[model samples]
Target: MKVTRLLGSGVELADGSRIAAGTVIWTGGMRASALTEQGSGQRDPLGRLHVALDLSVTGAAHVYAAGDVTLAATDDHGNHAMMACQHAIDMGRYAGHNVAADLLGLPTMPYQQPFYVTCLDLGGAGAVYTEGWHREVKLTGADPARSVVA
Candidate 1:
């Protein structure tokens, strides 16, 4: 469970053990971008900075986080924001809008996206269009949904 040395040829463990290997790959959980640490706020286990419904960093009025740097609510039902591209774009818009409003002394709107959708290409099987968090298929292959995407 412990690695004392790791060289291109092999690895050495703390117990004076050596194992020859071709390559070593390290896989671990995701962490938020280092930029998230610029603000003083809480973070989730994934290291994503916590934010309010408005996407403002908790306890940091001048700090706002969006996209993958933040842990934001995705809907009123309490789903957390995802790191996917669609969710990132959604959060980015809210963060920008709220920041502008704060600068202009205007009311800020709460960020919420109750619906989610995805379109995936299945190669020879064509593509599929799915809706909602459950990923219910609404269209497949050459269906009109595919046309809509086109």
Candidate 2:
């Protein structure tokens, strides 16, 4: 699918809904709302159920989170993905490592996300891989090579 780089609060259609926090809220395939203000006291009680990554799950550990939903957390353990598939792949690997390390009592790994990549299909026969989801995508850093690295 083709995605557009929305500016400002985000792009919306004829209606009045908005998507903020870089999330794409859609209606019948059109963007309805985007995150204008991320983690604005929005809490999902359900998210509290996710298992936390602590220094030790054996009831003693220094667990922490670094992501968008940290503010809205009702309890512990809440985070948002990279909003891109590349980061998903990266996070998947990191999650596996954490599980193995914690289970085997092995060392833990640090989370390091490079960036994001997007494939935009132009017209009928052209595509571009960008590093970010903004207008500055054409800058020196947004080169296709950077996307390939992701």
Candidate 3:
């Protein structure tokens, strides 16, 4: 199925056709907690807390968050962190390092994850290992080259 445009309660197609949608299930990413709303921290469209370069909450500098809970810019183009382990691992390291640095009166490490990768489990269809933000599947299926190297 191909989608062209979106209507109020329906959608328009490239063939100049309109289809009324009864339900729209957005397959976006994960959803973050609403705890940020209780604080002075700002949240993004996904409800993830807006964070500074040091992974600290924007308004609440004393609080630092990582993983899917924070909406830290991953790139200069304003790409925020995606809800994936690839980002969480790195973000956790940076968050911890920065917090320690702050206590030690040293410079904090800025959060930056320029690389994006995904390993999707396709079930009966096997799996795929993707690379980069575009998520180009570099290795797929039962191919021998698909083995993940440490």
Compose the digit string of candidate 2's lDDT tens values, residues 52-140.
33211222243323233222111133333433445445555655676677678787775554344566544334446555434245433
lDDT of 3 by residue, 1-101 (tens): 56677778887778878889965555646788877679877787788998888898887856789998888888787677888887888999999998888
Off by over 4 Å in 1: 1-30, 142-149
Q: Candidate 2 — worst ten consecutive residues by lDDT sum?
A: 66-75
What clash pairs does model 2 have? 18-33, 18-34, 19-33, 19-34, 19-35, 20-34, 20-35, 20-36, 21-35
Superposing all C-alpha atoms, what RMSD in Å does each candidate have to the true structure?
6.4, 11.7, 8.3
Worst 10 residues of 1 by lDDT: 141-150
* Model 2 Cα shift for residue 21 (angstroms): 30
TM-score per prediction, in order, is 0.71, 0.39, 0.72
Ranking by lDDT: 1, 3, 2
Model 2 error, position 48 (Å): 9.4
Reference-based lDDT, each prediction: 0.82, 0.41, 0.80
Once superposed on the true structure, which residue ranges of model 2 sit more than 4 Å away at CA? 1-80, 123-125, 133-135, 139-150
Q: Write the per-residue lDDT of candidate 1 for residues 31-95, one digit (tens) a residue.
A: 78887766668888778988888988999886778888889888877788787888899888989
* Count of backbone collisions in candidate 2: 9
